[model samples]
Target chain A: MKINRREFVKRMSAGAAVTALAGCMSNAGRPAAGRVVVIGAGYAGATAAKYIRLWAPDIDVTLVERDAEFISCPLSNLVLGGSKTIRDMTVGYGGLAKYGVKLMRDDAVAVDPVKREVRLASGASLQYDRLVVAPGVDVQYDTLPGLASADAQSKVLHAWKAGAQTVALRKQLETMRDGGVYAVHIPKAPYRCPPGPYERACQVAHYFKTAKPKSKVLILDANEDVVSKKGLFMAAWNGPYKGIVEYRPNSELEDVDASTLTAKLQFGSVNADVLNVIPPQRAGNIALVTGLITANNRWCGVNWQTMESIKVPGVHVLGDATLSAQLMPKSGHMANQHAKVCAAAIIAMIKHEPVNQEPMMVNTCYSFIDDKNVVHVASVHAYDASEKTMLPIKGAGGLSDKANELEGTYALSWAKNIWADMLG
Target chain B: MAVAVGCPLNAHAQDANSIRGMAATCANCHGTEGRSAGTVPGLAGVDKTQIVQQMQDFKTGKRASTIMQQLARGFTDAQIEQIAAWFSAQKK
Candidate 1:
């Protein structure tokens, strides 16, 4: 259905304003006012905090993040391939301050939904009129038997967060002996970035081909097939990096012996010089701690329109931590899009206006097959009224024709533009 | 001239604000307020009909693009018109 802004506001304002007013009166005997505290300043939280201040200057917005700098996961695979550096992918929070978002470098340990309070590790408590949590995803190392130990985890680097681990993994790749086996274990579906493990495989293969000529890259994927951009990834796997990259599907990792650098799969074990295990993941720990996670779900259940927590009022969840519908991959672009929708809805609710019933979001993910070749998958999702979920627009999105150098250039440009959109 | 039943000549300020909210997504590539700095053309001050026509072309296969083709198809015709109007109204 077509959603015109004027028509949508006209239709929704009457009913929405009444509901919001009633909620406000019951809670505070007044309109929703005061500060908004956003936790975890990743793409979602940072964008939400920035937009709240930009759209509604009167309302105070505070962004709480443990790290002072932001490291991007989008182009991070380039780091593993020696194409990009961590410094190139790193951004500071100083740009966010220009948007009037207060930046707090502190860990938020606990959140009290009823009190609308967030307690920090620094022993400071913050009260909020609205709260947005974009904690991303947390890797569940405990699910893998031998990976729970610190020594094992240190050896089996996920490097999913795009920081020190990325560098360490890169170093491991660089130091591998010629003809050494570099094994990568991919978890099952619903993981962050569907094509990410494949991209990692390609990147490492590219590195092995160029730097360590005889070194081989082995991919042990739990899923039966490539999760995304399957055609393009398969073409590249068989074309340029053939024989150098070997893929084994349905190889669910059961255990890891870090001392021997061996990953025991459901059927057999694979020994490698460097083991990169992308472990099973769930919502950020804070979601479970704050009771935002719904029953039988590892992620937080949120209203797609407003991103408000299904179980808790005055709290919203975004990014990978949210159990989003419409096959929304847990990618940075989707997180940024989710932030915009949540930001708009929060602003409308605060002003006693109707939140837009139909919100449109776009996700464009690019994967580098090599230093010069890249492939992408793009989709546009809109709120489906009858289904009550976000669904991809039919015939609106698809994968790139094939991996190409031009798309690689576009991929880099896309990263530069999106980073500027979020931080600059 | 008779006014259309659903189309208002002068929309509310809030309506424009909401339109801007949706249009902000375009700003990622189109540039802030549709004032582009790169090779991608700016939509600011462009004719609404021209913008709408190009978007329609992209949505269809008539006008090929590396990414715009997929992105344009996401919106309905009505949303496209609104986006066109929003960008056309902006200063160049």
Candidate 2:
């Protein structure tokens, strides 16, 4: 316990040593703090990693990210519409280094929770006092036929993850004939980004309006009605792009035929020049491999106060991977909010301080109907001691009155601020 | 950490971190610790009275906003005072 700070730094791993030195400088009299290994550098994990170091500089934070750059899923639809490029949504992880978070550019292939370690694909192991898993979502192709193979998936792009496929899908629309039908199949509810599919429709339709007037944007939704920002999206579809966009609800997908570019629905089949099928989704692969999917074997359950896994000790799950509370949506903004709360809890836990009994989080999601006009859904969730969960505050959140250029500006500004908040 | 500067002696130290967590929800649009990076106005170093009053106006429809009107109504009066103080204490 009386070991010198320099000795401790030399004894620790490269990743932990630098942070330990920083901690020693800032926290002169304190002991070297515990280690926190966070998996997936999306909105949640990146924010968590940064905030943990910001608040409690003594703790060693190592962030594991497979991708060299972070491509945002929000505003990715603009790339599909040709309004923005993939570079606009991509950012580097170098910002995290400034906060003393060691960036481990490797995949966390396995978790040994009992031994309190994570095994990376590079044959390296990370031991942690706490593990944060924010693996976003994994789109399951096996649930749908003709989409299980790589060739079929290549032909019918999901573009849901917002990277290369986003650009490829844009290419498909650009090359499609003037009058060709570009159909997008929406999966059932509880998918990532509830209003994403509809916003995507508007984006594609906007492209169709300018480039190919006769081209149609078809929305085949499995849900009975619009899932989020219903009135706002309806107004856009009816008022602006009335002739261009078509909506068919309750059109459940039985299978897909990539060769014919047809979506085989339970009722019938519809052929299209470009078929974008957003298949059913579950928690990411790491969540699956770690056996943390507790809800319907799809989402992990967590203690709302700390986001610690209900099934496993010392492991916390965040963002879309967790079973959402009553009113929470799987949006990046909400994920960022979740990261702050998790970071605060982890810091307090490390310091043996009392975790906040009352926690409040807010979600503000903006969807661009076109490039300039946007609609949004906002809500606030407060921790309820009685229910032991976060409950949406009544009358505090709602949809935008309508789509407008002002909110569209706020949408981009929001993206810039949030990205800076997480990555920087 | 700047939140501790202006905190009254009567304020519970633990409650400071609690308010910090609550105030961070605003950082998605506002910048970290309310130092905005984009079109949204930064909240850092603003007067507590001004911040609280604006939040009250937004909540009561006295101020018009693209999204703040809806977000302001979420916080109770007491919570707004604490959050305002935290942001007010931060450097611009």
Candidate 3:
């Protein structure tokens, strides 16, 4: 019973067209129809909103975001390294409008899952049949000492969100002396991007090696070692960046003197011309307010099958906000994968079709070791029915053999292709 | 010959959405509907057998790539065949 590819597509298209026409007719007759409201216009939310509109045009989909433009955090380190600019990374939401997704330029202050309403900062409330929340992560600055005051915190930039703070940190780096020390403090596991701080270290080191050869990059890591692509990162640090980058493991940042650009470690303190304090993070603030942080009160927990909150029905969590199964990296690519699985499930639920039981996702993360050398880690994950979680499919993916100039070229091409897929 | 190679994929038409969902992940790098907008080769309209053979080669490390080798190993033979069929059916 084999079906040819052409026959399959033809049948599927015919079925879809007929179903969609019926859905449109029904939607036109009903004044109040199915509406899905997505919070946060990020990798996950944007993809979910667009796909929902593309798959189920009868459903009213609205994407609520805090900013007018989306700034990618994936390649933001290049901005700090002077290889890219904020403008180059920022994209407007106008492109999503073509998919019939309404863009709401406002912050989602509160979510009433039981009431099926989201209250916005602009004194407006949106009702939803289903809600997709992808608010990313919120850094806890209060956990770090000497960063309680707005004035003090201004000097120590995280730049993890990839917007104003990114520009500020880049500017600070530009103003530093040729031989100055640039310090970066990384929090423990489950931060936004697993390989981000290491990649940042590499990018900054590359900058110093070329533009400020005498300067140095000091990486203060709380983790035991580089969490992702450790071998590759270690090779880069010991090889091309031997003299420029200094990596210290188990050096958790206890406090900071932003005024003096001094990091207070358990053993001692180190002063730098510029400091980047990326504090411990949890799910976005809205998730906390909505009681979605069911796992250790740090991240939202959802069923791996549908990405729907285990505690709240009809509410889904995606991207960095969710406590995914072990071995899942909190990455943009994973978020995009979550969006597709979630979108498919939501569409099926609305149309009374059987949701796909076996969902497979793939993630590939690239790290720029230098301006021309890049390394990567990739894996495929599949839902385990018995385990009730997504686990890596062994033998399907691994780290790059080594960082190389060709990977660097692929890294750029990857960024361009992904951004177009998400926004174009 | 190409059409014959794609026959096995048609049996799983009931899982069309799942197949499409998995294939969509490739678009992040391959381009929308596999019509690459960059230097990465577009998969749309490529021969199913060619796509399947290349993926198998990548999985086996016969074809060296910065990322594809690792990515190719993510799927089983059947899944790879289905993905190849999906893209091969797309317009060039």
Candidate 4:
């Protein structure tokens, strides 16, 4: 952002000349009015990029994503349930074009905070007045030594990222015999989507109910109990899938015997027809490599009001990569909210306007117990100026009373709306 | 000597942007600017009073809801009014 006046003027496009010139009047050293570079095209980054441009048409936004299309991890569990497909979850970046966001199909290999630049794998460097990084999570294969090898990873799928792995896991289920056992190991807390593993168990169970009734669904949870929508998930497991679904708490996986299809625990090992090992996770590799992570060496700490990285100025972190605030789940919905707050704040900062002081965010996560029944957990968070972080509003958010078919209809609509909100 | 080309946003513009931020949060389930893609009801161009009343009903549990009852409690009455007004201004 610290560029010579001539260089700044030269870089500004013809359409942006007016704003760029206006920016130069107040301060000789100020960055050109609106040059933002956003990395990752997931819920957070895509929304941030699009909203920034939508709100301020003059602002220049360049979104760098390694993948050509966005594969939503939100409804990916449905693919395993045989209710949805990978094609259903996939969305293209083509929508962003109408909003004037420049799309770069390349990996963000490194970020230079000092230089205010992002270096892509294509050997191109993007200079930015501000940087937004929403890299999501990095599934740590290293944490599970047994699953570190490529062969082991292929045999014991994670399917946490919601693309190829999701389809691969579904294929495995399709191939399993009618009486086969499918076991999934849940990692410790502070990972993306606490309710996700439980939902997956339901989806797999639903698939088994109609497709392979004799099949068993085993959940080996590392935590002492279910992490999210616990009561609702418990009701589903005990009610509809009583004999088919088995829940084991505090079953921390020691390692995996991929070849033997065994999950090694502290006391014993459980063998299954298929094993899914969701390894421990941390902030995505880009966040880690760029030294954006400040909390427990896992997540990037941020100023909640602006979503700006506390550790690095001129760089904002969003979505699952961030150290979530109190009661904030790392969800696509929450990330979309983060993107808006961050977008509004960044726009204000560039315009030298007062940022929104009392920002609020809400999270609503729905989980489908079966193909027809769904439940949800909701929370409302507002900034507490005194505390310097967002706190869940007392008596504001709560869980659903019960799982019902009505919620299932709403859940799908919610997905469609949110996808359009971020991509459309 | 400095040249003033694209001037900074005025106070009115800033206020408008701030409210837009709050309203945009609802877009996750409601649709961008309240234009829903399907099933869920759209909020754009609705009467401000109607929107406020509906939010109040959800907050008070007078209107049965699967999720709104929980989400509506998150916003203050004043914030709800602002969001309602913003959505009322959006094109249907």
Give lDDT per model, in order. Answer: 0.85, 0.91, 0.87, 0.91
Any idea what lDDT model 2 has? 0.91
lDDT at A344, model 2: 90
Ranking by lDDT: 2, 4, 3, 1
lDDT of 1 by residue, A1-424 (tens): 9989998998787767676555433232344456899999888888888878877787889999999799999889999998999999898888887888888999989999888899999999999989999998999877788887888889989998899999999999988899999999999888888899999999999998888889898999999988888899989889999999998999999989999999998787899999999998888988889989984558888998899998999999999898868678899989988888898888878866667888878888999999988888898898888988789989888889988888887777666666766776
Q: What is the TM-score of chain A in candidate 1?
A: 0.92
The per-residue C-alpha lDDT of model 1 at residue B31 equals: 64
Question: What is the lDDT for A315 in model 3?
Answer: 92
Q: Chain A TM-scores, one per candidate?
A: 0.92, 0.93, 0.92, 0.93
Listed for every candidate in order, the interface RMSD values in angstroms are 5.0, 4.8, 5.4, 3.1
Clashing pairs in 3: A3-B10, A396-B73
TM-score of each: 0.90, 0.93, 0.91, 0.93
lDDT of 2 by residue, B1-92 (tens): 54345333213546889999989999999999998988989999999999999999999999988778788989999999999999999999
User: For candidate 2, lDDT tens digit of each residue in A1-424?
Assistant: 7879887776775656566555423332345498999999999999999999988898999999999999999999999887999999999999888999999999999999999999999999999999999999999887787888899999999998989999999999999999999999999989999999999999999999989999999999999999888889889889889999999999989999999999999998999999999998999999999989999878999899999999998999999999999999999999998899999988877766668888899999999998899998999999999999999999898888989999989999999999999998
Native-to-model Cα distance after best TM-score fit, residue A222 in candidate 4, in Å: 0.6
Give the least accurate 10-residue stretch of model 1 chain B, judged by summed lDDT.
B2-11
> How do all the candidates rank in terms of TM-score, highest first?
2, 4, 3, 1
DockQ of each: 0.30, 0.47, 0.41, 0.52
Candidate 3: list runs displaced more than 4 Å.
A1-33, B1-14
Residue by residue across A149-211, what tens digits does model 4's lDDT show? 899999999999999999999999999999999999999888899999999999999999999
The DockQ value obtained for model 3 is: 0.41
